[model samples]
Target chain A: MTGGYMGRILFVNLSTGEIREEVLEENICRDFIGGYGIGARIIYDRQAAGVDPLGPDNTLGLITGPLTGTPATTGTRYQAVGKSPLTGGWGDANSGGFFGPYLKFAGYDAVFFNGIAEKPVYLFVDNGKAELRDASHIWGKDTYETEDTLKAELGRGVEIACIGPASEKLSLISGIITRRGAAAARSGLGAVMGSKKLKAVAVRGNQKVPVADKERADRLRSEQIAEMRTPVAGGQSFIERFHKYGTSSGAHRSALSGDTPVKNWGGIGVVDFPEPDSLGGDNAIANLAGRAGCWRCPIACEGRLKEGTGEYRYPAGTRRVEYETQASFGTMCLNNNIESVNMANHICNSYGLDTISAGCTIAFAIECYENGLITRADTDGIEMTWGNHQAIVAMTEKLAKREGFGDVLADGVKVAAGKIGRGAEQYAVHIGGQELGMHDPKLISPRRPSQPSAARYQADATPGRHTQGFGPSGFRGHFLNAAGLCMMGQMAADPTKYLVGFMSAVTGWECTMDELLKAGERIANMRHVFNLREGINPIEWQVHPRITGNPPQEEGPLAGVTADIKAQVYWNLGALDWDMITAKPSRRKLLELGLDDIARELWP
Target chain B: MTSRGSCGLKPDSHRLNTSWYEGSRRGQEWKYCPMFRCVVGVFGLPREVTELREVEIELEDGARLRDIIAALRREIPALEGDIICAGEDRLTDNYAFNINGRFYQDENELQVRPGDRVALLLLASGG
Candidate 1:
């Protein structure tokens, strides 16, 4: 038996209503680790290429990493993997919450689902048993209501990851929501689940994930926690502001510094959205009802807002707005009404949609409206003007429900641009098909062609993603995700010191940094191979001119800076042994990473 | 303080006049030249790294960017080896240095005026 894995994978064919359990191979667990690493390997082998992302042929897996249920610090992560309807390529997104650990406790390391059910159904895995149940009663409910209803029926401890009405409508930007807030909200994978008529997966388990060296793992965890608690010699205590404000702590500063994209990648922050301190970190937690966090996470970087008392009324225990949501809704749209942004956050959370994509799409629509490509007639008489907080909130709800103009934008900027025609696509800023993250590439390192952020966005299997690193740094991030570790926790604790150490202790493998990095590289290559097999080469893709700073900004902090994103992609592709022109991994590099099967398949 | 590029030292950056040092030696104290005072804004670094929100640093006339790094290190020792390499002009990949709002990388010889605002922003990506 594998020490960290559940030794079992549950496969459910929704159309056939057949449920089967297969023993997970120890070698697969060791080589791929877990989370999307395992998901990628399995999907690349089992799922065929050129299949419709929303069709019965597409396989969607809710998979967890080895350390997910273990006592490892911040080990609450799982990956939702399948072909993306949005990007039409390899897709995977990770989320941190109680659902991942509880899924493992439900006696499976992963669950793969395919085929559309005859009716709406939710998969219930209680202890060692699994079955599909009719979900007709909760079919059209929001994520929160669905979770509440399920928890009332099944014991309260039953953790669930479910889609909302948005997904039921097959909105391409919809995401799976858990704990009423945490979401696996990328790659448009929730639409895949919705397409299968699968509403939710509720899990409750007591099974212990076997650890090779439980004592050593516990000891290492304690040591790391202590290290995190210890303050630096001369400076203030670390993690204080993060614990207090979460990611929101950097919102105002990041915007001012040109890190956060402003005016949908057009306007400058200090010039257009100055004095956004009301939407800053301090203000974000001001109305907090309490703090929240993922399973067993000590940092508890999440803030839950009290029910809104003033303008925008939301339910209590609403998820506090995060930096990305704020930047997307606040700076991108030039709307600084904190309450409206909070209301928008609540709307997105309830409707199970991606805030980054939803907010960015709104900003894109606003830009289109300003350019005369779209007008009030197209927007159902809404002004759709920049900084119109009321319009922003109204449009967000419409987007969630796919009503009126929102129907045109429900799929995201790329699709919306395609439908809008009349040169509206020029204002629709996106990398690949997905809307770009809040961080701007031009601000990353404008002077250097080998900028880190732009390189990742342009070169990774998943385009327009942030936080994932480039080269060895990226390998480490992949390994961390595969191991079910939180990136923020590792970053706060210093990954170099704790990541490999925790891996060795948990798996009883003498895992070194180099070995794990290689594993990460392997996982990265596997995802890239999946994309390549589907004929999606990011190398030939043209990035948006505004994102690349083609003409460069004229004013504010990032004035006169142009980022050569193509050069950055080339630099990263070279470092990763991917062809600069074809964007395929070299056969020798694949063999070096022990992907002999993939090498033979590609070469043959 | 005046902004960067306002001080006319870019053309003769390499040829240090040493007049300021000579003035000091002659018992003339360092004058408050607006060109020599840089307002440093520190954000995104963990509190354990620095509690300094903003700092105003005074440098001698004709001071290179390295001199400012040295001064910052002296003020915040916790920055040594992690944010800024110890006794080196190079900085770790953890943060980016923005001189008067323009992103600058590996430009140690760049001249700084007194009113320039140097922002040390943590390199953050993702949500």
Candidate 2:
């Protein structure tokens, strides 16, 4: 083993209660690096194509990268990978908290789960000794209560990744909630865990993560931290801003700049929501009770909001609403109330729902009501008007519990639109089945004829994610995620040069930017193969007309600017060496990336 | 000294088109001097410079946004090479400037006026 890895992968069969450990091959480690790359590769090789995403045949892999728990800045990240119940394709969601480092300390690189359990159970990995324990008492609880009960039962130091009532009920937008309010929130992977009757994964370990060279590792970490402290071209250093205001700091400005989507991507920012600054970073900071950071992260961008006094009152220790959550619940609903946004965030965290999808679905319902497609009778007598915070809160509960009309939206915006029928599909602003994130593609300049890179990023196999890292400067996310670094940290301190140095120190591989980016491209192609083999062709997938600027906004900063999606996809395919017509990675390109078998499988 | 086309206004006058006075100080002849003044608000500054959140700047008429940024940089040296480029050509990606609630992608072409509210905002990306 070079360094930075436990070199062990634990495989557990829930149906038969069989547990086994396999030594991680060094070649695979070197090629895939770790995290989602390793998880994607394993799932692709093991999972048969076209299996039901929520069936017993599907596998769930929780993985950590090389830099995780190794003194790397923002290294506390783990990826949950499986077939997405929402997208029905290659799905993965990454999160940060103490759980990943604890898993690493427990002496395992990854945990792979297959088959369905006969009863609700939780996995406990204690210093590498793993077992399944009955979780009948904790089955129906929310994530917060579940974590508290588990900690009381299994000691305070144990870290957990648990699903809430939403996941337990098989809500497709549910996510895995971890400690310090970190969530692997996307792709409906949490529901996959629920499908297997797995309630939580609790880990406690004292073993140290092995490092190749401690002195070199320490040096690299200090250098990166020091660089982070210095202000770059911006007047404020990213570290300082994060430490002070967190990610929601830009919410006010982003609303004005056409970055945050408003009213389900159908309304103009200034017109639909006036005084947007009320929901921005300043207001979020004002309500901050404290700040929290992921393991080994110095920025501590996670803000903790104070509990409110009356109707909006939530538990005081809840994490601050992130930018996406704020945009989703705030501008997307035509509501500028930060308190409501904060409460909505708390509800989603406790219930384990993807705030982006939930907010978008609610916006769709509101639009449906406005268009006279749905009435008060359809909304269970609650008026689905724009900016109705009460209705949003009420609908969120119903959705989490799958109660009444909430069951219609429990499957997500795509299925919900299909069921709603009369012109509701046009109201659903999503790419593929996943709801679009806050950023508008119209805000980004197209490199060529009206083709915005932002739109292309959203059109990837795992559609509707803003963080797919496909912008002109977004290639860095692939390397950053591979190395277990946070995107925020990368933005603050340029990861291009620092990641190369850090990788060399940890892996003793003398890594370079070119090699790191090549690995990223390889991982991306490998994921694309996973989708292709499962019959997901990116070329044929629909990009919502609203996102493509179909009619174009009549007024606003983005007026008359349409993202030429076809041209954009064509440009993206050419850049990635994918066949434009087939949307498949070229056999030559795959072979060059050392994916010879994948190339053959794709070609032959 | 030549009193060529002297407007009846003092040199220190804050008026928009105040004519020149004391022409002997420089070799070049002075005429009507059109000046543009505006308030610039700089947000997210460190605690040490928190009091310098807003500042008033005056510039020659027809001054582009770059000139206003240059003036601000000169006034607040700490802001130099931070949000504003060292050469004052454009804002760095880390920061964005908003004029009257509108975002200016190309600062070079933006023109400032006396009553314009130009805000220097720190650019933040998502988690």
Q: What is the fnat value (0 to 1) for candidate 1?
A: 0.21
Error of 1 at A557 (Å): 2.6
Candidate that would win on lDDT: 1
- Residue-level lDDT of model 2, residues B1-127, one tens digit each, is 1111112112244453443233433667756557655656554431114345356666666667877666656556566665666765666655666565545645566777777667665434444
**Which ranges in model 1 have alpha carbons more than 4 Å from their true place?**
A232-236, A445-451, B1-63, B67-106, B110-126
Question: For each candidate, what's the DockQ?
Answer: 0.22, 0.12
**Residue A217, candidate 2: alpha-carbon lDDT:** 80
Q: Cα deviation in Å at residue A259, candidate 2?
A: 0.8
iRMSD per prediction, in order: 4.5, 6.3
Query: For candidate 2, lDDT tens digit of each residue in A1-604?
Result: 8788888999999999988999989888888888888888898998899999888999998899999988777888888999999999988888888888899898888899999999999999989899999999999999999999999999967999999989999999999999636899889998999999999999989988888777988887888889778874446666897888778876656665566778888887756774677887688767788888898698888888777766888898888888888888888888888888888888889988888888888888888988898998988998989999988888878888899999999878899989999988988877768887788775543113333445554656588887775422334566677667776667656555678877888888888888888888878887778998988887777777787778877654455556666766677778888887888888888989899999888899
Whole-model lDDT values for every prediction = 0.82, 0.78
Residue-by-residue lDDT tens digits, candidate 1, B1-127:
2222112222334322223332233466755433355666664442225655556665666787777677667656778877888777667665667775467657878888766657776555435
TM-score of each: 0.89, 0.86
